[model samples]
Target: MAPSVLIVGAGPAGLILAIILRQNGIAVRIIDKEPTYRPGSRGSGIQPRTLELYDILGVLPAIREVGEFVPPMARYEPGKIEPTSTARLGEWVDPTPDVPYSNALSLSQDEHEEILRTHLQTLSCSVELGSELRKFEHFSDRVVAHIFKTDSDGNEVEETTTFGWLVGTDGAHSVVRKQLGLSFLGETRTEQQIALGDIIVEEGVKLNLWHMWSVPPKLIALRSGGATSKKFMFAYTGRPEHIADKTITRDEFIQDFYAITGRHDVKFGPTSWLSNYRPNLRMVDKMRDGRVLIAGDAAHCHSPTGGQGLNSSVQDAANLGWKLALVQKGLAAPALLDSYGEERLRVIAQMLQLTTDLFHKTFASLHSADKSDDSGWKRGGDLAMLGVNYCGSSIIQEEPDAVAGSAYMEAEGGRVQAGYRAPDAPGLIHSGTPTTLFTIFNTASHTVLLFGGDLEAVGKFPQGAVRVVEVLPQGHSVGALAGSALVAEDREGHAYTGYKLQSDGFTVVMVRPDGVVGAVAHDTEGVERYFQKIFI
Candidate 1:
């Protein structure tokens, strides 16, 4: 099939959006201007909410196999390397039935992209490296783009293609975003610049703990690179005077490391990558412009302090993918695409506030009179991103009780609501085998869980666009239902408890393709009403 979607930039956002659209059988062509897959440990933290999304995308297992938990930081006082305190950046929590992946996973951004790329390839789509989106024109019906492709022999060729949609996942200085004329409004924190790099530590450093040192106005930190033994990722707040007029080099990194830690004994090897990172609290005024849209760094940029940059970008793609697929398939009106920006803009606005506030708090605490204050280093709660929802989104239905303004509010006491994350329930018996809700949920279509065993409700939705499941109580026989819907027995009552449903009560939950509860209805009429908004 010819590609229907043209994605600019093969980073996580673009890769994930391609993966999702392809999962729905949407053909996509993803391109990046870079000569090869980029390498770096940029934005290494994967929040719990992202893990849940990856679970549906079938990439979580590989991520978990290679992903390492955030290591404890070995805090060292000046001139004293061996004697100091150690602490984890975030508290580790045991997994629950509703929340299977509770802790943040740490793997370099490059490794993360490789996993996503591999998954995309499995779906029969590959990213076009050295293919740059030079220009694009968006019409009411389609997007026409001109791309520059450099072949192996260094020959440059230009091609024009028409696509149903165009998405810019290109980084901060996005050519697609500039063409759309979207306002990227925010300021750069020049005072909070940090030098980041990946290097080989020859000796005298352990891989278990992230080494840290405080130099009052500057902070230096290093952690082991999970993919390789001798490699490590490090960051240092460089002194303005030292970095004023010189280019960043391996020698400069070595000098900064030695100056900050006073550890002349620690030997260093080759530097793989180095960059001067200045935090920018900026986001586009909107995420879409007709047939052209933007996601990830192309749409927003913020501090790396809370590790929310990449996670937010990935979520942006998740939120937009299914919507675009529906529109492309002609299953929904074009206005369905409007909710993509309406829903995400509100969430991104709050995320910017949270991350920006966290950034200020972390740096303020670090440079305070009490150098031993670790309060700012603590992370959990909202930082885990489990609370992110589209409660007030125009697409959500029958959620009168859901708060309209904030997207960060968690469903109180595990109470399920429209727009909240669809909770996962384990110990479900499907065809005499134990299975979980996460495994049953489909990423390509909406999942309608019929707790009342209303087999007739299955007829209300389009066949391929929705999957209907009948949830029976423990010991209930599935023989009574004669329908196409899959039957799962809640053998351990986890499904009822997690969703706040009584054993005999009938409840219908519509889990969106993104794994968010789209509607909590009392009957088939409400379910039909909800799908009316989603489908034409």
Candidate 2:
């Protein structure tokens, strides 16, 4: 099929973009340079915010089935039977009605990719393995990609196709980024090197926890929280000079394992995969070049210290996919695509600084307790990614009432504001069904929420592209409105409290497809004006 979008690199970002675009009735073709899906548990941390996106995308059920909470770390000294130090990986916070997922979970990166692929398959799209994008160029209105695939006799057959848009979800050394003549400026850590792998071990080794040995110049961490078939994820790094940037042999691994753990009964078994490399911190200055764009590692890369790489990339896809869909449907102008870079680049720059800071702090904390804060590590609420917002975006609009007391609109505690993440409120009965804001937020479409608005005003909504929801305040005439088929009762006042709707005027909050509030208006006239800037 001739696709509207040709996505390069079928990793998390590419797969997610494809899935979302396909779900929204846009044709997409996703191609990967890798011959097969990569194995081993690399980039295994799924942040709370990414988990929420997974729920909205209809993949949380599968992800939850295979995912596990981050187990506390048991730090040990060399040749010692007992642990010398202990630090919980992260504190577990109970789920709130507003923030359903409040902590990070671990799933092997490969497992995470598999889950994305599974859902993509359900959308009648699958990754084209062993297919590589060799070259491409953008014309006046479309992008043409040159792809090479192996034929029946192992001969390379080249196919060239044109797409309305081209996206590179490729990696740090993305061909798309290179082709666009963009620069990825960052530094490489020659001081850090490690041999990481997934290996089977004896039953003496326990599961559901981390085994860590942090001694200056050398470190070894073994975690089994999301292990498949009882195989532990092993990362061995010590003495940058001694660490090899290439795969190590079994004998070499065994010697290093014993040297660190000082345990004889727990033996190492067969290895499934091995890789050695020093990570780099890099990001593209711009995420788009006309019709060609990039997301995920193709846009930015950093040390995996804070586990933000994957989550950030998935968000990149989530942000770009819907904008591309809207543009493709002719509902929005192509200029809407420009905001993808502006909004995402700001977050990426912040992430690079955050991850780099954490990378240094993690190494610094090895010898002494962190005096900066009670938490030895910096994996706190910020790391949950719930705080990441696009409040600075050009498309986000807020009226005077929403930001009356502040110099500018800001994210208040669980309050819904323009450009902030739409807060979730439970105990809302819609169509005789009990639901939260998230239930209606599952679709890849604009949602206009009316918190105590006139019932007849629902006819003013932009048809087909928006979901109109009328939320009635508690004890404020509990009856369905003729303007909306989906009317809700805020029985517990969570919606009223979250929206600050005690005022007399109707509070109209427009949420973008990616969950960021697009606009806040006082009435139907304001709603139409806000959407006129959005839909063509």
What would the TM-scores of all predictions be? 0.97, 0.93
Clashes of 2: 2
lDDT of 1 by residue, 191-301 (tens): 777878898898867876788888778788887776356788887774685563344688878887787788888899998898888889999888888889999999999
Report the Cα lDDT for candidate 2: 0.80
Query: What is candidate 2's lDDT per residue for 1-536, written digit by digit as tens?
Result: 56899999988889889988997889889988777889988888999888888877889999999898887776666776666665666777998778788888888888889989989999888899889998998986988889999976889999988899999998888999999999999988876777788887766555666777766556788878444447788888773464466677767888877776776667778887888868789998999889999999998989888789988999999999988998998889989889999888888888898888888877676655442332435475677888787765677776554442211124775567777777778888876678888777844688778877574655665466788788887766557666565778887778878776674567788888777788888767878877776778
> Which runs of model 2 end up more than 4 angstroms from their true locations?
227-229, 240-243, 367-378, 399-410, 455-462, 475-485, 503-505
Candidate that would win on lDDT: 1
Best TM-score goes to which candidate?
A: 1
